[model samples]
Target chain A: MAQLTMVQALNKAIADEMERDSSVFCLGEDISDKDGGFGGAFAVTRGLYEKFGEERVLNTPISEILISGAAIGAAMVGSRPIADLQYGDFIFCMMDQLCNQAAKMCYMSGGQVKVPMVLRAPVGATQRGAQHAQSLEGFFTRVPGLKVICPATPYDAVGLLKTAIRDDNPVIVFEHKKLYGGKRVEAGAIAPVGEVPDKEYTIDFGKAEIKREGTDITIVANLLMMYRAMEAASHLEKEGISCEVIDPRTLVPFDFDTVIKSVKKTGRLMIVHEDTYSNGWGAEISAYVAEHAIYYLDAPIVRVTTYDTPIPFSPVLEDYVIPSTERIIESVRQLMDS
Target chain B: MEAKMLLEMYEQMDLIRTYEETLYYLFLEGIMPGSIHQSHGQEACAVGMLYGLRKTDYMASTHRPAGHDIAKGVSVKDMMCEMFGKEDGCCKGRGGAMHTGDITVGAIPANAIVGGNIPISTGIGLSLKMQKRDDVVVCFFGDGASNEGAFHEGLNGAAIWKLPVIFVCENNLYGASTSIKNTLNIEDIALRADSYGMPGEVVDGNDVLAVYAAAQRAITRARKGEGPTLLELKTYRIAGHSRSDGCAYRDDVEEAEWFARDPIELLKNKILKEKIADEQILADIHEKNEQIVNEAVDYAIEAKEPSVDDVLLNVYWEGD
Candidate 1:
């Protein structure tokens, strides 16, 4: 096993899957070129076209709608397509094709057709602005037929992407822009590290990983927010707060069982996310936990999220809007005190 | 040239008409579950086009897809069962009238979204071409769809790739009551094909023979690596956009005009006028068709409904 960044893990998964299945082909903007824009905006698909030919690792035009529609159609007719959107925010242009057509086709056809496609979208606030920085998991999770996965570690990124490619249904894998250990325009950025398996393997979805062990409180988070929650847990450990951190890798078939069991032990729950507070993914988790694990809870669940406003381009406003480590710490301390 | 091929065309037309009429009555009786976009007047376009296609060749149809589905060989029983929301229906009762379709029959489920099937058909064509298959895709859309950006994008893409696709526009004048004349700048929807550098042809859609002849030419061209064609069938819909409306938007004069030249009646007269079949043979064909339809209804009525547990099934394949 070797320690790899999330970007390296994604490249490995795609490279392995390409070698494993001849049907798998990747098409997106700037996914093919070597130094210019290999892999993607995060370099996840770098060195694929070099190993495979241009035919397999295709560089498409800047048409998101056509790219998504073509991927859906290609998948329907029998070609496993892994389409990449530069940012998750751009996925709005192709939502009809992804949501209505790809998601509903097999079900609408009564199990007659299968859309075996993987859509890779990079999400998270990196101080880019309102257009680029958005945690798009909330939008996609609402769609019924789509499988939404947001992997937090290198191991999970490799395994989950492999699983998504092999899946018959269309799967949307959202990678956090800040979490990818790569160069950013700004001075400070998130660069979480994890080890990845050298051998080929895939992890099952709907499973939660307990990042840190504790008994006093449970901190639920995903993607970039997961790292923030982990940092918050570390700080609380010094004060004897002993908070548990749970990361749900996949949102669609969420691993609620693991979280519920952890909540039972801890007797307190708190959710942290970068998405807007109103109708964010944290609300769903909070509601579910409140309904099922109410008797086990010691205090009301607290949610620390970005303010209900569009992501601003200014660094100061953006920092204030998004949930920071300080905010997570405050929320956890409040829950524990209560 | 052959007599059986001509008879097959007529049979398919009759089947479409009878099936639509049956669905109409079922809806009127309050037995059917969903709304329908019937293809009462455009049977010739479906029967004529599909009659010439192989089972391997694919067809992507529009909202008014009952005719195309039946003509392309979707079983009547499954279609009726689907309308009844039974599990045994073609789409396990998930898709209703507007989306009625069967992939095994070489028909992707009929898309209810206007012009949505254009790019999808192009994709099917791409797959066929990539695999080096002789199969061609016939994408059936409405006149309203010709004005859609999807139509332009899909057609341009298909033409540039020289993919084997037949962009069939069943231009029955209106798209949900808004006349094509109001939406389109050009008089003939087929003319848009010239912009894509593909051959565009207009045919009397009500005339099955004319439509069949045009389809044959396009299919032959596509089978070779000659690229795509846009065939605009000048036809009309006798029914409203769906089951609820009375189609009052259509002029009575134009309605009477199209009815007089009914594709079913036109084909019947051609058969009788040319002495292709006698009264006895016609009677026998009608009786056999009635029996087939009756048996289909019986099978559909007796079909099972999917359990609540199965709702979660088929969302993703769990590997056999």
Candidate 2:
């Protein structure tokens, strides 16, 4: 086992997959060393260009449509491509390619072709204004054919990404900027360093991991929110309020069963996410729990999400807008009181 | 081209023409479901560009894709079944007229979104280059597609990487109801290739041999790893943009002029005048294709509707 950050784990995962499968290749803007070695927006692909050579690690122009469409096309013809976007917000530029083409190719083609590709995007509120900081899981989770994955820790990052690379369908890996612990540090970044196993291992989608075991309440979160939720659980433990924290590794093939089971034990549920309030992924979980495990609930389900507005540049306003551990604790206290 | 090759090209063009004419009537009779964007006048463009391509070479098509799909070697029966929304269709009834294709024959399912297939073709080309394969990809779109951002991005990527992709623009002078003259400021869509540093050519879309010769040059260049070519085939669609269009937007004089230069008739006259084949041989080819199309129609009419239990299938590939 070796201690690694999320970015290092992701780089290792890509390198390992490329080493194993010749069909696998990387393509994005500034991904190669030829483009001053930025190694993608977060330096996750830093040494890949040198290790794999220019043919495998391609540097594309600032054309999101071409990157996405070409990835879909390459995937259609037996190439497993890992396409990267600088920020998750840029995915809007290639909506037709992702939502229309890659998502629907298999069904539209009547199972004639499969787009075995991965799109990696960094998402989080890092004080970069509205266009840069957006939690895109909500938007992509609503898309049917595409699988959405958000890995919070280094271990899950390697395992989930490896599995996504092997899957026969298109998957979007939404890595939070704050969680990608590397040189480019942000204000609220957690910089979690975890030990990744030396042996090859893959994490299946639709499987939830319980970060902390408790009984008073179930806290469901992912990516940056997962770390924040863990912090809240530790804080709540001092006040005699035991909290169970769950990280849903994959959003589309959501591990609802695990969440429901957790809710059953705690008899209370509080969902947290950085995405906006209205129609967030938390809303879906709330509804699902209300439908299946309502009788087990001691209190009404609560959602702690960012306010319904674009992410602002100001640090104070950004913290106020997005969910905080204090908000989670207060929400948990209210649910406990009720 | 040999006499056999010329006759085969004529036969394929006629098959597309006859299939489209048959579908038009079936649609008129209310027997066919959904709408269609027929390629009635641009038969030579599809046949000429795709005639000699190996089954392994990829072809990406746009909304008006029946001619491209058929010419790319998707069986008439499969296409006919797709038009009828039957289970035996190439796309298993999921794709209607605009989205029919057979991937086994290197025809990716036709994209219904205008200019959607342009960038996708580049990806296929990239895959071929990565695999060290000499196979090429031919992407077909209308004149209006040249103005789309996908066209610019796709063509530029192909040029920079020298990917073997042939971007074919069938400039039928209109996009749905709008004329290219009103939409584009330039006279020749091929000139747009200069922006990407690729060779661009214009062909007489109504002349089968002329289109064939241009395609030969472009395909040869691609096979030699010389990069992408943008070929603008000046042609006109004999039918309306879709099922409901009465074509009131078209000018009668221009329509009559293009209609007289029918690609099939041009090929027929060329075949007879050049002594490539007698009139009787050309007539027999048409009759044989008509019979084949008729058999396909009968097969499609008898094909079963897709099972509801399987409706949820293929949404995600479960296994082999």
Q: Report each candidate's C-alpha RMSD, comma-separated, in the order given.
A: 2.2, 1.0
Among all candidates shown, the one with the greatest DockQ: 2
lDDT of 1 by residue, A176-240 (tens): 88778865533345766788868778999899898989999888899988988888889988988
Clashes of each: 2, 0
By how many angstroms RMSD does model 1 differ from the true structure?
A: 2.2
Taken over the whole model, the C-alpha lDDT of each candidate is 0.85, 0.93
For every model shown, what is its TM-score relative to the native structure?
0.94, 0.99
Report the lDDT tens digits of candidate 2 across residue range B1-320: 48888899999999999999999999999999999989999999999999989999999998889999989999999999999999999999998998999999989899988889999999999999999999999999999888899999999999999999999999999898999879999889999999999999989998988998999899999999999999999999999999788899998998999999999999888889999999898889889999999999999999999999999888887666
List fnat per candidate, in order. Answer: 0.50, 0.78
In model 2, pairs of residues that clash are none
Give the per-residue lDDT digits (tens) of candidate 1, residues B1-320. Answer: 55677677778887787788888898899877778888998999998898867888898987788889888888888888888888888888988887888888788888887888887787777777767889988999999888776787788777877889999999899888888778888889888898989999999999998998999999999999899999999998888888887877888898999989999889888888888887778667777777777787888878888899888777765453
The CA lDDT at A125 in model 1 is 77
Show pairs that collide, candidate 1.
Answer: A39-A45, A39-A46
